[model samples]
Target: MARTDTAFRVIAVPPARAFAALVDPAALTAWLPPEGMSGRFDHFDARPGGAYRMVLTYADASAAPGKATPGSDVVEARFVDIVPGVRVEQAVDFVSEDPAFAGTMLMVWEVTGVEGGTRVDIRAHDVPAGISAEDHAEGLASSLANLAAYLER
Candidate 1:
């Protein structure tokens, strides 16, 4: 069965700044990876219909084997929509041979300006069965925290 996971964080930056971090390759490489993982993009183009390939490597793969390889998760994602200061949506797929991880996931990132800063909400739809809910939640939260730090600094 397909499932959805959502996470939100109040970042201490304006919506534009938060949205910029979402699309900039350098900013993404700096903050998109969750705890214990590091990410790099093979190619990046941030626009509607543009696509990018990202590889995420685990610092300690023994704890959690990757979906694409023993130590890494590779993702190919296309931009579905990009609304400045509001939202960025993407169609993402895991580059894995395993059947459990075969599917295109919709990742929507919405940023709304709040009193103190921005409220960033992430909604992931049709998450692959191979990814556990608890782990995904933690990963999302970790990435959000990283984003906050990246922007606030």
Candidate 2:
């Protein structure tokens, strides 16, 4: 499957601070979820091959879809690689019975130092057919925007 790519620039925040917002569990909880969602991590281990589980709840129950419950979406993930203040790669699978949403997808986040801030580029490989590219792209953009906002503050 073709991958989905998204990139964003975070002004006034260096690579280290931007990368911290990516790896830190507390910071992740604050900004990982896109607009209208809240996230909780059951456990997070920030190392290669480490496992984690995250539950994302929709602020509006009506916004949830068939692939997940009325108010939440669950994901089981493992860190494939971690380069401090630089990049993070992970393999993620949705905990849903829906066939279209099944399967593991690789997500890579590249952080680079740019003039005045950091540039974050994200790619999702083998994205499930159940998820539309448009929505995925939007969600990614929103997450990146969230990260920028969190870091700049």
Candidate 3:
């Protein structure tokens, strides 16, 4: 069995702003990063069973396709739970013919009401055997940093 890890960060923007930064496709693009990467929401019904998909492109030519990390060039997911303006949970999986995923990636993006803004907690489970918990952790942190930057701007 693979181990699952939780990554969390408390955003400083107000709830509305934080939430806006979350659901707004443009806002998400502004911060979602790692060089050569961008994403768009396919259909954010924002409720359970609502489907969502995103495209991730390799920014670097030197990187092999198999080396494309999670959220690197492609991601498709569905909302597992949504609490309007409060929280959004997702079941995410990698969409790849890369022979790596073999199946969909399962993940959750949880937003909670905090003192000033919202707390973001990302739980990624059933991670592929080759995936790196440390790299994912760094990526999560970077994304949160980008989110903060976008929200504050």
Q: Which 10 consecutive positions of candidate 3 have the poorest summed lDDT?
A: 64-73
lDDT of 1: 0.96
lDDT of 2: 0.85
Q: Which candidate leads in lDDT?
A: 1
Q: Could you tell me how far off, in angstroms, the CA of residue 130 lies in candidate 2 after the best superposition?
A: 0.7
TM-score of every model?
0.98, 0.94, 0.78
Residue pairs with colliding backbones in model 1 are none
Q: What's the candidate order when arranged by decreasing lDDT?
A: 1, 2, 3
TM-score, ranked from best to worst: 1, 2, 3
Top candidate, metric TM-score: 1
lDDT for model 3, on a 0 to 1 scale? 0.68
Candidate 2 structure, TM-score to reference: 0.94
* lDDT of each residue in 38-114, candidate 2, tens digit only: 89999999899998999999888786563567678898899999998888999999988788898899998988898
Task: Compose the digit string of candidate 1's lDDT tens values, residues 3-61.
Answer: 99999999988888999999999999999999999999999999999999999999999
What is the C-alpha lDDT profile of model 3 across 118-137, one tens digit per residue?
78877777776555778677
* Backbone clashes in model 3, listed as residue pairs: 56-73, 92-105, 93-105, 94-105
The deviation in Å at residue 81 for candidate 2 is: 0.5
> In candidate 2, residue 39 scores what lDDT?
94
